[model samples]
Target: HRFGITFHRNKRSKAAINTELETIPGIGEKTVIELLRHFRSVSKVKKASETALSEVIGPAKAKIIIKHYQQTTNEN
Candidate 1:
């Protein structure tokens, strides 16, 4: 199957999950590892505060992550 983007945590394929996160600006493989280590899951990451995320991924990337989620939130 072709690679696809998905926000749903139920996706069993790691490629799908990684592809989705990689779409977020500034989130590459290293950051993805950091995020997963810090938050364990996407839901946890989505609910994390900027300050908490900044501590994990630095404030700049934290802002990007927060903004990305916020924009996705507003769009829904």
Candidate 2:
């Protein structure tokens, strides 16, 4: 059914997002869950301000995540 296909696609996308989050050093499963629960997607996470991210994962980790994404963005 079309609904089944849509569900599978959503699941796949969520997994891909999780995989990308996992690649960030010092971020583990718990932090990934927290990020996803709060931001819902990697795109949202990337756009989130440091204070916003700190609300979910604390200031120290938020800076690290922001720095990591900024570095990756600069490299590209």
Candidate 3:
């Protein structure tokens, strides 16, 4: 607190959420932001179809994301 930085509860929550998304393979900050903006939540992003994700983040990135989720789902 000595640095005079104000603690924003909302930002802390957002950071935590972003961190969770980043755990998914091939998802970086920009990709996470795009997912958040498009799908609005981790579950939605996970549930998104390859085509839907491609619509938001492009085909290459979408394939990576879709594959990661598909692998995760298959493992469970």
Candidate 4:
């Protein structure tokens, strides 16, 4: 006799995953999606210059994002 087993995986929104962007105070789902789309990854987003980030997310949010990363780096 032979037996087969199957496993099911749960589908989750890309923004709902364990994302550092979500941890930032002013960032939300829409912004996370936009950042991921433009920069392709969180690491790229973290490293992007204020001018580059502003191009994608505007000046206000770019500043918030940069500051968040800077503080996180210093804490580490």
- Least accurate 10 contiguous residues by lDDT in model 2: 12-21
Q: Give the Cα lDDT of each candidate.
A: 0.81, 0.89, 0.79, 0.85
Give the alpha carbon lDDT tens digit for every residue of 17-76 in model 4: 868898899988889889999999999998899999999989999999999988989999
RMSD of each: 8.2, 5.0, 3.6, 6.3
Candidate scoring better on TM-score of 1 and 4: 4
In order of listing, the candidates' clash counts read 0, 0, 0, 0
Task: List clashing residue pairs in candidate 3.
Answer: none
lDDT, candidate 1, 12-72, per-residue tens: 4553455456789778877987888778887898899999999998999999999998899
RMSD of 3: 3.6
List TM-scores for all candidates, in order: 0.73, 0.75, 0.71, 0.79
For candidate 1, the 10 contiguous residues with the lowest summed lDDT are 1-10
lDDT of 3 by residue, 1-76 (tens): 6343445665656666545668777778888887888887888888889999889989998898877777877999
Model 2 regions lying over 4 Å from their true place: 1-18
Candidate 4 ranges beyond 4 A from true positions: 1-12
* Candidate number of the best TM-score: 4
- Sequence-dependent TM-score of model 2: 0.75
